[model samples]
Target chain A: MNITSYTARAPQLVQALEALAQRADNQDSASTLFHELSGITVLVAKKFTNDRTADGMHDAFHLTVGCISLGISQAGIADSNEAKLSFLLQHGAEYVFQMGFRHIKELSALPYAAYVSDFDNDAFIQQRNLKAIFLEICNADPVSVWTGDAVYQNELLDRKRNRKIIDCAKWLRKNNSNGLVKDSELDANAAISIAVIFAVSGDGCIVARTGQRELENLIARARETRPDVEVNWNDFLKKIPPEFQPILRERMEELRGTIVKKIFSKTKIKTVLTELQDHYAGSEQDIDYS
Target chain B: MSENINLPAIRQQVTELVLAGSPEHAEDAINETAEKFGDLAVVEVLNTLEPHVASLHLSAFDGGKMSLATLLIPPKAWAESLAYFAATWDEDWIEDEPEVLAESLFAHIHGVVFGTDDEERRAELLNEALATDWGTTAFAVLFSTAAEEIIEIANDIHNLGAHRSGRTTSDHDVIPLVLEIARTNEEAWDRVLFEIFPDWKPGENELHTRSEDDGDDHEDEEEREHEYAIGRTTKELLLRLRKQVPSKSSGPAKTGGRPSLGEDIFS
Candidate 1:
């Protein structure tokens, strides 16, 4: 079939998948639906490659659909077509744009004659707009888009800052050094977790402070993005051989403790550690800070 | 029918006949054996003989380019040989037998026909085979003929990693030829397309309605719109196929009026 035919056929393939997904009520059926949808996408990709007009840019659209659909299903997202569509559109759009922009470097080699002249610049314009929209929608502190060296350097700095913030937050949670901390008070780890949650959820930027209602929204968003996020420790331990489980758990605990101590030492919260040490050493009377 | 026929020795004689470039002798040996036993036993033995022959030679085309005349048998011999197998293929037996017998017969036909060594000439022979009439009791023998090869390629890709095959040319080069055969008449195209996409129907385009309960997000709405556009695009392709331009009626190039988009990287 020609590109025109493939272009016509892709939608019905997607619709058929949608119908199948809508009808699926169990895991096996949902898996089958996802498998068929993936197959259709793969076939479309194969046809796109066969198409003479495909410059790897047109391929990005189908590749995105294939990757995102596969990712959502593999990520154990809900089988409902609505949920799958929501995740795919939210995540896959940026991926498509990112892949498109990434290809521009390779595309620079092609002669002007290679361009699909009849397509004009509409596809190119749409791709450019998608990248811009991806950035706007993500509102990520350290944008992952491939820009020139200067922006990359700044992104590195931003990432370093985030790492430092996360370390401090993790320390605060472990030390519980704030004295009778309330559930309402989020430490550095919770704040960074919320930020990562928003970054993944495609919900623009993380707000400065998460109120009760805002935290609830973030939780809901996290649930949508990572439905299988929870790891059952008991079931996990049962799977691990009995002899290895205790050692593994002990090593994990030790690792956590060591990281907390290191973070506490580096952070401003080190003063709380100093106070506790001083009281233990009989150098000063206990002073309640909270 | 006698157990004293010593089928293994007979099969070896046939194998040597095919290897020695006496496919006619090999076929005669098979026929004489089939008369004693049945077509199934002869076919089973012939099935083993094909692999021996295949190992002795290469495929007809190299990197999608047709080589000069390489066929051992004449064009008439190829026609006669294919007709023999087509006539012997039992209608009721198809369901019970492994498709291997049919596959082996077609492979033998292709092996001999492609030997003519000219791509265009080989294509013509293929066209003839596709048009050949099997007896009324038999299934459309050539219905899934070309598609079966395409399915083989698909299966290979599925089993082995695509890159591991170390193929020099894309399957598209051969696909056009198969499609040409498949599209000889509307029935042929219909059968091939049905095998490829079973759920496809003429009315499916009209049956699809706009999805209700659009999610409360802008992204969902945009994706839905894109999907609608894709459906419309596929509808055009389906309509074009429905119109059915004759496939093999023309030249060997099978260009089908699609402009040369650019240099194929595979080339």
Candidate 2:
């Protein structure tokens, strides 16, 4: 009926949802629990809209509940892999914050003269702090919260680590043909696939050495934030479409062959033209040239 | 029994009567002359006064063959008087059969009492009568009395019409007078009187008798004063509820970690 009534009711509802979430967390069925929690959050939102209070505390409470509910829902949907779920939770948190900000903007325009004045800024600050805590939890050590044992053994990690180095070396050899590749787009494209390989290797150094501007930037950012963090890059890369791997490998090989041949020829320009002609000639015989 | 007065014929006669008399004594003389036709059916009085009266008129239908004397008075009164006569008097005095008496009573009142030119006003009166909490018996008596009055007026005016030159009076001159009387009484008395007593058209004096009361207007003003307050309270309640509800995200950030990068690259 009024703001006081709504405020009084909100906590009890939130507590119920939290209890359900806790059960879900313990049971490792957060997804089902998250849906139930979302339903409760939606009810709270509907009641908040029905009551139409412009106070910031009221708005913040509803927003915070909605955000956390959404974050948990997203986390529930994510792969069991801690890294991926962390990513999803991060995105969900961002989305919730944006939603809350929009609500704040709308609340500011309420026709009641005292609406904005009655807002509780402290409550909003507390909500912000809670969000920071959530993000910290998401970014924390995956092993600490990870429920399952590591799927990638050291043998696979070593093999992936070696394969990544060889792939990077091959890409570097192809791109540097004629002494320099010069074209940033071509170099970056080659470097990206190579970086994925390094990511799969669990060796951040390969990413560091790729020398592609974007790859370098990623490495720097990752190091600064989480230098010692051991990311199973191969597991991360497994999330990518399987079809992309073959295409990436084929392109890298083709580029490497052309660059190596171009570098060896006495007449760099003439050799490139001859190689291009030969490649096209072979394609024409196999392909319909009409 | 007095001669049966046809309404048109009576109207012609009353016109002549009114034309021959001074306006001051015309109303009284018309009333006196109409009373003389008390032995005639109420329609006779109505028909006789048609010329002198502008708005009111009446008609009648046959009610089989009753003793002609029994049909002369207003049908309602005539029916009661006949019933009294049949109960008290011997069968030899009842020349007409009981069926004939019933038919005569029905015909006299059905055609003469209810019939009038002002159908709208009559309908309004009927609606008012139906809405009132009067008992069925009381309502029936009132309806019969009103009908009888109309028939008597019609006959009286018909009888009085004999004195005038045949010229129809304007209905505007009579309608307001009847309406004024009808407005004052809760029952349909004015309609009944107009139908039975056509010579008497309402004058300025009758219209002046009614007064207006201001109590309803004051109540309306009070309701208007609180209307805004109620509206404001409703909005306030809704506003408070809205504040309690959760808010949604506005839009994706232009630059953010994974999502923005993914969106930009993919989209």
Best by lDDT: 1
Rate residue B218 of model 2 by lDDT. 70
What's the TM-score of chain A alone for every prediction? 0.19, 0.19
Any runs in candidate 2 off by more than 4 Å, and if so which? A1-66, A70-180, A184-290, B1-267
Q: How many backbone clashes does candidate 1 have?
A: 7
lDDT of 2 by residue, B166-185 (tens): 22343322233233323434
lDDT score of model 2? 0.34
Model 2 quality (TM-score): 0.15
lDDT of 1 by residue, B55-171 (tens): 222222222332221243333333323333432334344445535444444354445454555766565555544443321001122223333344444334435634343232445
Candidate 2 residue lDDT tens string, A1-290: 56343222222223333444444344533443344334433433443333244453344345445444323333334323344334434444334334333333332222211111233345775455344333222221211222011211222344444444444434543543234322222222334444343443344333312323333343344444443222444443354445445544554455444533342334444544344335422211112222
Q: After superposition, how far is residue A239 of candidate 2 from its true place, in Å?
A: 28
